[model samples]
Target: MSSAQCNKSAITLKGSSEIVCEYLDFGINSILFQRGIYPPESFKTAENYGLTILMSQDKEIKEFLSVTLSQLKDWLTQKVVNKVALIITNVASLEVMERWDFNIEYDGDQSQGDKQVSDKPLKQIRNEIRDVLKQVASSVAYLPLLDCLCSFDIQIYTKDDVNLPQEWAETEAANIKNAQCVKMRSFSTNIHKVNTMVTYKNED
Candidate 1:
């Protein structure tokens, strides 16, 4: 195949990063709605991946996620980000109740540099992501209910060599005591693969 033909079929690093970021946005929103971190009325239905997703309508939340995803896209392009976690905590006690981890894996050669590409079809990758989101939406059945008022924060794990952003600070890991973990399906863009897992406090 000619170089131009090969390039035409390739998924660029930036493209994969955007896909991954979009998945995280939808995944996090689904978790928030399913886990009741926010009121049901705070979300609105949106179509994506052939599914109707509930997305946040709050201005502050939208802005926060927008900025966070933008930053994540940059890191993902650099291939420095390893995992992105959503930590849900009890508002009154400030104790972590659940942690949703979207663990990332580089599916391409590291030495190929940022211009590397993946041959995976976008449609297939999106379908895989849709399946994961469906499982996330249905997870409320087995996951313990969050009975108290809760809040959430996003923690990003990056390579140690990465320079910390001035506004970002280090913090302790969000771990649940007597935790029960559930691993869900994963999706890949050929360049990047993401594994989904949830760890929650085992009330029993």
Candidate 2:
């Protein structure tokens, strides 16, 4: 490949990592808005994926997601972490209400080397991510409403051998009792593919 051609097509590990994190940022915000975990007033609409997306405006929530995804991007670039889960719980009862799991896998031959690069076009990947976000937005039609006050927490599932950060302590998996799951669309950047699913407490 010529120098210019390679430059146009190459997608580095760090670049793909940033893409995944950005998707999570928008995806999480979409869920929070649709599921009514936070008041609608706390979120503002922004354009993404050729559609309007509501992102959280709360300062603390924004900072939490920013820092968490920064560390996660590093793990993603290293191919150490496999899953990121967003757990929503009832604030009053402390009962697990809903869980959104974003399963990650290194895609194609890119996983074979330390320097990950893919020829997949960025526009195509963004379209795929848009489809996933659309599914999340329409999820409210089938998913149950959050009747009580709720809060959210993010959990990262990493490989057993990876060293933990001083501030990052391990916690038990936030499993929901009598859970019913709904599988959502998956998106890929050729270098990485993320499969999304939501498991919720079954009221029936």
Candidate 3:
């Protein structure tokens, strides 16, 4: 019996939004560290969700992520965005090598107002997050090792009417070539459910 099948406790709308953003913060930092996007010394590990996770300490990166996640939280509560991706590309060739996609699903009637919580337990949600982070920590075992210079971009999908943030530019979806997609564990906040998947260039 998987933990995900357990009972879910209800939480308020605000709580659900916070959970999504928090997961994004941890997920981004973990992926950046695991995929070798930055120097190892730039990250420090902290205990979270019953796991030791590496988090970024760089000031500029920190600010960037905060702003992005803050904006994302609003959309999340409104059920505006559907998917977000952390894309890694080769610096010289401009080729996408890997993509970590987090798919957002929701089922709450926002018209009823923002005070409602999801029907899932908070503990159950955390366990699901832990499972994905564990997979990220062990990614090297299955993901191909990259030897080229790489850079990453955080791209999200939203409708055109979404008030565009000045810093965000519209770009085509960046996908990997000959990709192998691995489905990862997901958690939900009743109002918002997030599912994760990782795709990398199939070297085989």
User: Number of the top candidate by lDDT?
Assistant: 1
Arranged by lDDT with the best first, the candidates are 1, 2, 3
Model 1: residue 108 alpha-carbon error in angstroms: 2.2
Output the better candidate (1/2) by lDDT. Answer: 1
The global C-alpha lDDT for each of the candidates, from Candidate 1 onward, is: 0.93, 0.92, 0.85
Candidate 2 CA-lDDT value: 0.92
Tens-digit lDDT track for model 1 on 1-204?
Answer: 699887897799999999999999999999999999999999999999999999999999999899889999999999999999999999999999999999999996778898788988888998999999999999999999899999999999999898877888898899899999999999998888999999999998
lDDT of 2 by residue, 1-204 (tens): 598898778888889999999999999999999999888999999998898999999999999999999999999998998999999999999999999999999897853676768888899999999999999999899888899999999999999998888979899999899999999889888888999999998888
Clashing pairs in 1: none
Please count the clashing residue pairs in each candidate, in the order shown: 0, 0, 7
Residue-level lDDT tens digits of model 3 in 130-188: 88788778887889987888988899898778988788889999977798999887777
Candidate 3 off by > 4 Å: 1-10, 108-113
Candidate 2 to truth, TM: 0.96
Where does model 2 exceed 4 Å of error?
Answer: 110-112
* TM-scores for candidates 1 onward, in order: 0.96, 0.96, 0.90
